[model samples]
Target: MTAPTLRGAAAFVQQVRAAEQHLSGADPVMAAVIERHGPCTLGATRRDPFHTLCASIISQQLSSKAADTIQARLMAGIGAGRRITPPLLLAASHEELRGYGLSTAKARWLRALGEAAAAGTLDFRALGRLDDEAAIAVLDALPGIGRWTAEMFLMFALNRIDLFAMDDVGLRRGVAMLYNRGRPLSDARTLKITRRWAPYRTIASWYLWRVADPVNEIWV
Candidate 1:
């Protein structure tokens, strides 16, 4: 398959610069993180909504390696292609999907997602036009999708720049390390701290994720 074009090249760089400046000035802890991490290189990999959401489901609660294994099996089961569309996923049986290493519940969720896509109940095209809240609502309304997952879709799929996923464990842990001196902060406190990130919280969140796992490569 042709390589997917990188989304929002000039705009993403500008946002990264703006976010780094704001974050560095607003909080010394974040400023240090910025200094260490240098320029934010996070950018959305071009993916259709269906495959992105499906991949998110596959990734839930699994280590990156494990998730990649399951996803590879799933793709091989469906067909030998980088893209996994709703029609292709729907063509597979539940047992077949389960054999691809998905838990039964996740297999069901994938099927439900496929059905929704097939029926036009979840309009991929329309989602791009909706604002963050509305788009999140649409994603969260699907079976097995939650706020975190929806927010991930926003950051990694839609490339929305302002999202701060308050419930992300890595973000919270990173915040604690950077701001709270290695103590986990309450969700309320986390949100309060992240408020300064504003308009560029997604970029900040990427740095925090990096802080949380310095050895692991972060994928968006």
Candidate 2:
């Protein structure tokens, strides 16, 4: 089966090959993961920046399943086209938005995002031009978006290859399980271990996420 299209995904095969080779050689633990997983087809997606950001906001504290369910309901509520564009969100009344299973706060966040997009303050393309930290800072300034969310947007939406969210539960778990052998993970230790996969950490992350089930894969 084909992979789901991810935003800012690799268009050049050379880089991906280099990433895999780097990870394989850098850490034996990651090498085992890559050998088992075969390839890193990080979840396929084709969402635009604004749409991806909206999804990220909805996903803030919810499980992937819960977030997907609410987003589905919201898109269905919007119309048959199923596009969550700024204009569509801006056109909906706040009450109408909440009725789609979003919390009152989430509704406001959606409105804020919409307002940003409509006002030209949220330029998706411009984000690509900024370095990861600067771009993350820009996104962090937005309501409801934090370092983690901005990192995600940069990694997935902007298709940056080097970012690694050290604080992410999954990455932390992956590190502990594969390298530490169930020992407690400290921030400094985690940084030391993961930095070896640097410059290709995102790809390394994909393999790490696969550690629990090398035979089957899911983006979460």
What is the C-alpha local distance difference test score of each model? 0.85, 0.78
Residue-level lDDT of model 1, residues 1-220, one tens digit each, is 1112454566666766888898899888889988998787766356577888998999999998999999999999899498788888999999999999999999999999999999999987788889899999999999989999999888887777889988888888899998889998888888889898887888899999989998877454
TM-scores, all candidates, are 0.91, 0.89
How many clashes show up per model? 0, 5
* Best TM-score among the predictions, by candidate number: 1
Single out the weakest 10-residue window by summed lDDT for candidate 1.
1-10
Kindly provide the TM-score of model 2 when superposed on the true structure, using C-alpha atoms. 0.89
Per-residue lDDT of 53 in model 2:
85
lDDT value for candidate 2? 0.78
Instruction: List, residue by residue over 114-155, the lDDT tens digit for candidate 2.
Output: 999999898876777888888989999999899998887776
Off by over 4 Å in 1: 1-8
Q: Which candidate is the best by lDDT?
A: 1
Model 2 alpha-carbon drift over 4 Å, by segment: 1-10, 80-82, 212-220
